[model samples]
Target: MSALATVHVVVPARNEERLIGRCLDALATSRALLLAERPTLAVRVTVVLDGCVDGTAAVVRRAPGVDAVHVTELSAGGARAAGVARARDLEPDLDRGRTWVACTDADSVVPAEWLVGQVLAAEQGAVCRVGAVHPELGPAERLLHLGWLARHSHAEGHPHVYGANLGFSLAAYEHVGGFAPLACGEDVDLVQRIRAAGLAVVSTGDDPVRTSARRSSRVRGGFADYLTALAVDLARAT
Candidate 1:
């Protein structure tokens, strides 16, 4: 039996018109699966459009069962924090301890069991749940994918943290002062703070989300940059 009453999902987008649609579609499926499994739980998906100057907003508008917030901060951390605040505004009396805050990137496609897994982990007394991510690479990027897999681990206690697949109790999030306003590495920073505060953090390889492996990233030092760096290293070794 789960003790959680509500779950809020936050996605931050910046000129991701080409991929945000797929991301939301996957999220809709996950949301449906979660609701079907736990009929009493409340689920909300909010997409934060940060400094978008393209068709991204239109794509978000076409998606059903999702709320959108506009911000010009151009910071992933700021967008995420704004999304959470919007969720809180919608549920004025939300119980922080009993509420779960899940985060994912606008360019990632989450598995149908993503939300269910996080909810289950939260119910089991996990203050934070960090899942895994598998990059969606084209045939041309096979080497990059291979290199990534060779350097990454997919185990129960894997040492990986991604905003594309992270969830935490609202109580724990607030206690850590929430996410900082940074351009990148916000997910890692939040997790570090949570651990430093002595919260029960759960790292699982199950329900890995699929994110784009594009070289051009919206923010510096993001997954795209990491993948590019990996490719460079591979090139140097070859």
Candidate 2:
């Protein structure tokens, strides 16, 4: 088996029992995408249950086609690192050249054509495919999504990579030292590092990934609150 055939989607989850099931369904959908794109590609899902005192593990276990690993540690940074390591270890043949590691959050749902679209972007010469992630929307979730879209729209000039749905060639990830050990904004940090290394980053805006807004809502101060939060984050980063 070639390294590229061992593509794995690593999801770092923390107290996401309510959303994990939907995320898993999305993973299954993504696998179908892989099969459609390359019938022989072997796709795997790795869910790292981090600091989950809830039934997150059970949810993953019940979900079809998922490899769940429970890690009591609360650090998402560490959990993701461990998950990626486990994925690579499972398929020893997956060295830097042909393998790829995709990262997504357990609270997010992937598009049905997510994997196929990503693979196509990579094969089309994108070193790191920065995919867009939209907050799940509805009357109940409308405010949150609108807030997210508004704040993120300013980032239009640069391809925004959501920690919930991003991918990188194993070689590219290793070259850039993987995700930064930050409490948050790891996705943006990783993308910046990739570009700093002279790698071309492209986004799949045409096929966005949908992620639950449940977690975001917990901290969101309604629409106004979200805008304030975004301002603070951007200001701090700047």
Candidate 3:
């Protein structure tokens, strides 16, 4: 079992003002739950407002106990990297091996057990833990949502890497040189690198994070875009 200590949550957002507040609210709940379970554990949440020309920063400012970092770039990978760096700056003495870094999107709402599950995974000797996500689709998009569920697996040992519900030890993150500056697919890239480094990556379906199912995406080739593509394919097959 690994000696766990602090847990840092990094959220990357771009023009997500409409949904970021809800995301922060969910994270606060998760943070509080984790703290209640482990009285001495430390949990930090940081939101990286990347190239936002909207009210995203305002929402983050109103959020208590949440740190906001503003940047002029639209890269999700870069924003995640910047957020983690800010976490390090705030706590200069964080133990790389004992500290956990969790990444999620501003359009996602994590469950109350999100942080607790990651901390438990770390305590069980996992260097990285990849969880699942369920998109919050509207009633009109019921067919699309059902199609997506039919094609995707929501079980343990599933082959899915989502930044919206991913966590890793700071030591393993540093060893892999952190997330690359990619506009999209950065989560998959980071997980691939971790696996190549012979690190133990645990995949679980427990407590999937709720994410936006909007067809329009802030970043190209992101989850929204993927869903849109799936919708198109489903239409063609009909």
lDDT of each: 0.92, 0.73, 0.90
Q: lDDT score of model 1?
A: 0.92
Q: For each candidate, C-alpha RMSD in Å?
A: 1.3, 4.8, 1.2
TM-scores, all candidates, are 0.97, 0.83, 0.96
Candidate 1: residue pairs that collide: none
- Model 2 per-residue lDDT tens digits across residues 98-203: 6777888877788788888767766777768777777666775455555577667524344566777788888888888986656666677878999999987776
Clashes of each: 0, 1, 0
TM-score-wise, the better of 2 and 3 is 3
lDDT leaderboard ranking: 1, 3, 2
Better of 1 and 2 by lDDT: 1
**Which one wins on lDDT?**
1
**Residue by residue across 4-83, what tens digits does model 1's lDDT show?**
99999999988899999999999999999999999999999999998899999999999998999889955788888998
For model 3 the local lDDT of residue 190 reads 94
Off by over 4 Å in 2: 1-3, 140-147, 154-157, 215-238
On the 0 to 100 scale, the lDDT of residue 70 in model 3 is 83
